[model samples]
Target: MRFSHTGPAPARRDDWQTLKTLWPYVWAFRGRVTLAFACLLVAKLANVSTPIYLKDLIDGLGMPSTQLTVPLAALAGYGLARLMTGVFGELRDALFARVTQGSIQQVASRVFRHLLALSLRFHMGRRTGGLTRDIERGTKGIGFLLNFTVFNVLPTLLEIAMVTGVLLWRYDWIFAALTLATIAAYVLFTLKVTERRMVYRRTMNTLDSQANGKAIDALLNYETVKYFGNETYESRRYDHDMRGWVDSAVRNQVSLNLLNMGQGLIITIGMTALLWQSARGVVLGRMTVGDVVLVSAYLTQLYAPLNFLGFVYREIKHALADMERMFDLLGHHQEVADRPGATVLQADQASLSFDAVDFGYQADRQILHQVSFSVPAGGSLAVVGSSGAGKSTLSRLLFRFYDPTAGAVRINGRDIRDYTQDSVRAHIGIVPQDTVLFNDTIGYNIAYGRPGATQDEVIEAARAAHIHDFVASLPQGYDTPVGERGLKLSGGEKQRVAIARALLKSPPILVFDEATSALDTRTERAIQDQLDRIAQGRTTLIIAHRLSTIVHADHILVLEGGRVVEQGTHDALLARDGRYARMWELQQSRTAETP
Candidate 1:
């Protein structure tokens, strides 16, 4: 239930490198990219030629001594130039569409797959809300970066260069200098301001993520909030988080408007200077009216790309900031990765032993110390202890969720560490104290234990767990919906479903971690009978709290504060009148008084 983002963000020096990671994905479709560039060149050439045709058409029509016949060829050429511009532009987009879409898919999918590969400790510390939001933004960021970089930024620069060159050759050097100087200033200003504005957007995104986490946490625990009558408290907390986002968003908007106005002013100054020079030349009879019109057309055409650059500059900065979160998630390494040439676990006999094992989640808080136990082939061991006696830690260690700090756990005289985690876990089945199912059909959750299991096989496992009759009686039968964490089902019913799942797995070693804690006394007795029958040939480790439930165990070990204080059969411990004997007496007294 705890949630936090990794604090102390990396410095801005890493932002450019984050975007650089996408190059390989983009490069994968190099053939299409080359064709798209060719189309881009053709499109710009057509666009630049449109003004030349217009100038010529005007000059021809405005001739004083023209013949009576109309100049249809000039009019057709002018129209064709305009039409070709649009056609080539669209063709470029069509060719490059695959590159943009593919890059987004690969990057998003790679990041998601990497998150799954991370260890349980990383997942425990993650906030689901913020993690999902970062992915969503990062997916969108990839598309934005590819489209603008290829279609907008490159094309705009090409158009500006062509325009500047045409003006200097046809008119004067002054026209080219004014155009180049204005473009240089506009680009520099936009970049500086956009970088400054990124701080506001980065803050806004952080607050947005916090708000999302608060809301998701509240809804997931809806029953708890309602039981405590704290609905208003949760709402107030979410609203407080959103208020910071609102303020940051407003500042982001204001800075954006300022950026737009400054870009507009520079374009205006550059346009006016170029136009005044053209008109002055026409008045002095140094240039034709057609020349003046051509110059005006060139400045107008060039300014169009400059305006687009202003927008592109701002969006690119935002996109890069969004992608930074995803890159960080992908860069995290697993804390308990398997050794380089790890082998598979050969689970014959399935004997398990913890050889003087010691472990701690942190340096200062040890959960287990010198804990040692063994279960022989086809034998059973019951672990009994109070909370914080490290009963649960034993199960996690057996599953290799964490490596032991001292000593080792072995199976068949081989260290479990020598086997890959996947291979080691494949042979073990656990029915935990708390069973949380996915928001899916009951049959689907049951099938999760052994994927591709036949319908008859699923029904047979359910029958063994004593839940088949209940499931078959429902209107939807096996298709009954188990809401989030299986909340729609009663506590006893959920535990039955978990039993059915574990039974379906049929692992050589079975673990019952307080498996019947949620059932009533009668139901518990009946299920325990079934479990005892099923444990005949399996290596079973039963971790239980109630003494009456585990009286039939082959061996029992009582743990006190991470150390074993007693070990013997159920009758031997009781006959000795030790800690197990005292706990058994206390539980029997309560059981007799209850009914």
Candidate 2:
């Protein structure tokens, strides 16, 4: 299947667009946002006015003047104002948190929904852990922006403007000019340095992603690495990836600290210079000592917001990058998407056919070349071949996992592509070579193929799969917990459970890909009876390596290097002494040697 490069990770643009798109998510909770803004305004008003009370107190009762009554009253007023400011600040924080949490939940839900909607092929190549990280980062990134952008940066900027405007009207024009220059300089310098630091963060994020992928890959293939005694090799690869991550992280931290230190120094020097001028004015009677104290206090308050803007700017950029990658995934286009005006199929009376079909995973390689075959409606057929000879690929084509590069696959004498993907798959039930079971009860796993099936229907299907008795003997019977992937069950038990699932689906067309390959002779023989019963009224396609299992199949197609070498009933193919006959002889000899 060809994957179109369409998603949040656009060629030239990172996730910035996705972050912008999240405005709507924020707007969804407009009432909460409005409340947050109101709280923010109250907090800022209180915060910006605190220094004014100190100015009034100092002016009303001269310092060291022995005016205890006036001084005490001024102190009380300042304390009360501060207390109220703290309360509103706390309220604003709570409101900001509420908005952030809501936005995260909303984005995470959308990403999860889109992830599940993607086709199987897209999932085949990606690690589960990495995908999980992307989803988490995407959601949290948006949340971080919501909390910082609206609550911190926006309110702080508004406060700065209010302070500067008041300063200009009440004090010298030089104080206001100095405040503006200091702010503009602080922002410009911080932005300049942080832009460089962001390069390190971007590098660090890439290395982190790689490190995570390595760990996930190793964990998923732990069994293979252990069997091959390649633990040292895997560990070395992981260590190498981690080394890069650590190096980039260190650089990012160092660069950020440098930027913060410089910003602090600049603010300190700018405020000191401004205060010196204010003190000179006070001595000349143009301003008072109380006014100098006010000017100094407001400078600190104004720069308080400026302090964290550097971090917020950097984070917002990274957040945008993360958002882009997530959006890109949500926007992926299926090369084999159903055409417009597609219809759902209702008929089960249809023949399955490969009409001169050609397909490949890559442009230069063709796995199926002009393959043509027809299985009569309600007939059973088996395809036999070595791995990668197009047997399994043919089964996938039957389900439209991939559209043929050329030619057409037909059902009921109509092209299968005419039906929507869901419609095409709804009529087919597949028991793949490897069965995957969820961590749930035995009954849940059985009923997964038909979610609304009754308890009796589930038990009947299990009985037909020959696993009902085994499950009934368990402590919890149908409610017995099946560990992840049914790890608690033996190989044969898992296959039987899978068979039960497929049986319960009750689709007209059934495809088995090495259904009994993992079972012992006794188990295989027992299930063969159920298989025979199930195949009686349905169209079945079996792909198997064991020749004995399919001897009863009405027809078997022998494949070699993507071509059909021979095809016939078991007796006729045996007499022909072709590839199928040789395979049968080899398998029979092996069976005879078994204890």
* Cα lDDT tens digits for candidate 2, 1-595: 3232111212435444665678787888888788878888887887788888898888877656565447666677788779878898788788767678887888778878767666667878776766777777777777777777886789779988999988988987888888889889998997788766666665665556666777888776777899999888878777776787688788888887888889889888788889898889988999887898898888778877677776787787777666665666677766567889988888766678889989888899889888888889888889999889999998889888888999898888899889988888888988888887898989999999999999999999999999999999998999999886787888888889899999999998999999998798888988987897888878889998888888899889998888888999999999999888899999889989988
Whole-model Cα lDDT of every candidate shown, in order: 0.87, 0.82
Query: With candidate 1 superimposed using the best TM-score fit, by how many Å does residue 571's alpha carbon deviate from the native?
Result: 2.0
Candidate 1 runs further than 4 Å off: 1-13, 65-81, 346-349
TM-score of each: 0.94, 0.89
TM-score of 2: 0.89
Top TM-score model: 1
In the range 66-135, model 1's lDDT, one tens digit per residue, is 5535567767877888888899899989989999999888988898888877877888888888789989
The list of candidate 2 runs beyond 4 A from truth reads 1-15, 63-98, 348-350, 452-456, 475-484
Candidate 2 Cα deviation (angstroms), residue 321: 4.2
Which numbered prediction scores highest in lDDT against the true structure?
1
Model 2 residue 345 lDDT? 83
Worst 10 residues of 1 by lDDT: 1-10
